[model samples]
Target: MSTQTSRLSPEKVWLGITPTLWWNDDFINIDIGIPFEQCISEMALAGYVGCSVGHKYPTDRKTLKAALDLRGLRVSEPWVSTYFTIAAMRKQTIQKVRQQLAFLQEMEGGSEDPRKADLVVAEFGHAVNPLPVALFPNCPNLTDGQWDQLLDGLHDIGRIAKEEGRRLCYHPHLGTGVMAAEAIDRLMENTETSLVHLLLDTGHLAAAGVDPLAVTKRYASRIKHIHLKDIRADVVARIHADGLSFESAIEAGIFTVPGDGSITTFPQILTELAEVGFAGWLVIEAEQAPAKANPLQYAKMARAYLRETLGW
Candidate 1:
């Protein structure tokens, strides 16, 4: 990782990590699943104050909150897949957004100093990440008409989030329609900044051959949330050379905690965010095989790196 230090204050952002490291949500069959108690406990033990909800998280609000509170952890955000390109899925997608927002509201500490968890949305329609095809070749190219539907659908979704006291953070992901730098730029240029904010994922951008630092500098004003991780350049090269699927690349150990891999642009990216006075959740969200990557050990590695470099 780059050795550059950030000017961003530790208090400016809520540092969190996702439980996806402990339990693979996309490929549930890749089972190295640990108990829920151990997951959150290990996160807090590793010094994260918050986390995004995972598949293993309890459905009951009170139950989930209590478990997290015991370990000084809280929900940072939850991933909500949106099928905006497909007209039939639009209504249900909005409904799902409403339900997620309600869950976040219920998870809030109290009204005294209320901090609402933002919503993470991604275009999942025609997504190929979960399939068995090569991610690079299989990622769908959006038609002009599909683009219209997606942008319009996102506007409606963003409005609802704004009404509910939450910011909508759009996640540009691998094997999805909006995974590349150009797609991300188009989304940012067209969306209502107040309603739809960006959720910059360093690992995804780096793997897609885009510089994370450039994206951060370009969209810093609209970024409301972040997913921090590093990808092994060698692994990424192999994925492309071998025509690997997203799942296959992950299984091949393409992603890892920030400082544990070859992506050395994090410090520069974080510095850019700090310079822009960005304030929100910086989540450590790298999904890897638990058996191969050791979740707790990697979490600690990430925590130590953040402390050493960013003073988090």
Candidate 2:
């Protein structure tokens, strides 16, 4: 196993900002209104060392490299935010995973920009309500067959990533079937670490009622990337009371920037990452009400908080 260097210096933990922060229109959010090159330049101007390329953004190597070169920014990770039905065991779902792996492989090999050659992130385990009956009456959960399929699929993708000199980071998102701490443990245990890794999102962990800091300490060896977000517990309560869907709750402003919400344990989490020698990009990802706060301004504040409280 390749080990991360000991003690990531302050400079090593690159503070990155996703472009979605500034763009409000979901349709054009990933495709910034400005030219791709100009959009990247703006990100760099905002003091972000890197920008995560979402699947919605340009995935073509030529275009991606041009933008990175113009902005002097690195592609921290390719955020493949697709919903993979780990438990459905559907042929189409399995095919989508294959397609994603192929895309990642192409990006890894085609990009002349070395920074763009990092791992492709894949998320698993979301159980949206109005659930399918395969696992639940209205939600989707992994059946035994689906579980085996998911494991086999991940092993194949992991091997592909390793061959291409890339990595695959499995993201455990809240609202996903694998949201709980135990679920996360099971997912990790079932997969080969050499084939896939973890992308720990602190906000999701906390919102799911797990101690994010504890998970970080326990799985420090597997975490390759981190998404820094915070949530409001009151909002969470309201969502539960109203039986609001995750999408509806987000529309109602349940989530917020890392420091603007009730995630008081973040500083300790950051300290833990430091102790574990985790030197990677810390991306600020807020998918809340964009109109409530200016994204750029929010990012500025988030960066300031990270530096002040987290000693980043």
Candidate 3:
């Protein structure tokens, strides 16, 4: 038996890949034509057993499950945006979160498989995608009051998700206000450990010039979900130099599958995860132009690397 299939006791881990590498969910114009079946089929072909929700995915529970069932895949997590800073957005945020939880809780691949966690990134709103990176000069920072609201809102949502038997994990993104090491430290400091958990994405952490290994060591216990996208330092430098838009950075190949990027700390990060008995999906979530980086090829590369490094 392989560690990827069966690991040490008490930790239930699975490998998954997001569909963004095949089709751009945020920027529809990039890979508008990739079929959902082709993307997921390739994922299973690459030896992945789980997948995160993508824009092109079917929403009907039975339909999606039947499709994934045919390919032996299950949903790991789906991206949800919670705009907690704006007071006026509270009602809307809760309503949106409820809808997400309602649907995700019903999502099941097989009767034998365990339930996966729900993921949310504390972001402003949908209309803010492809944000102009140069405007912030660094990155957006939440006001003190907004920080309070954000933490409280996460608790509220976390309570709701718990009631529904799902765990909520927060993702710190590159274009969001929570883009720095200090910012993440502040979030971990202020937010309740149980109510609000972290969804650490190594690509985003490295892109923000923060060491993923250090962050992993600091918050290993709080993490319930993981994203293993690799990033290139030279491309990150170019983004800062050109003040490029978030969309441009992705299209310019700032992110890639693990073992193909400049970041070389995954072995330590995985060790830390194991040390803490971290359990859940370790998803590959690199957003690259499909024309340049074939998603299937990169998927194979990612799986091969993990297999070699983790002996899975």
Give the per-residue lDDT digits (tens) of candidate 2, residues 100-197. 55655654556554343345444444556323222222334566665666677677767766876677787776555667788788888888888878
Could you arrange the candidates by TM-score from highest to lowest? 1, 3, 2
TM-score of 2: 0.79
Instruction: State how far residue 311 of model 2 sits from its true place (Å).
Output: 3.6
- Itemize residue pairs with steric clashes in candidate 3: none
lDDT of 3 by residue, 1-312 (tens): 244323422236788889988988878887947899999999999998889888899878889888988998888886678888865898988898888876776775224567465655566633233665552265667788878888888889989888877778888887777878998998889877878889989998999888999999999999888899899889888887888788888889999998899999888788788888877888887899999998899999999988877777
Clashing pairs in 2: 87-142, 125-176, 125-177, 126-176, 126-177, 131-138, 131-139, 132-138
**Considering TM-score, which of the candidate structures 1 and 2 is the better prediction for this target?**
1
In the range 53-111, model 1's lDDT, one tens digit per residue, is 88888999999989988998878898899998976999999999999988888888454
Q: Model 3 — TM-score against the truth?
A: 0.93
**Model 3: residue 183 alpha-carbon error in angstroms:** 0.9
Which 10 successive residues of model 2 have the least lDDT summed?
129-138
Error of 3 at 84 (Å): 1.1
Full-model lDDT, candidate 3: 0.81
Best candidate, TM-score: 1
| True lDDT of residue 83, candidate 2 | 41
Write out the backbone clash pairs for model 1.
Answer: none
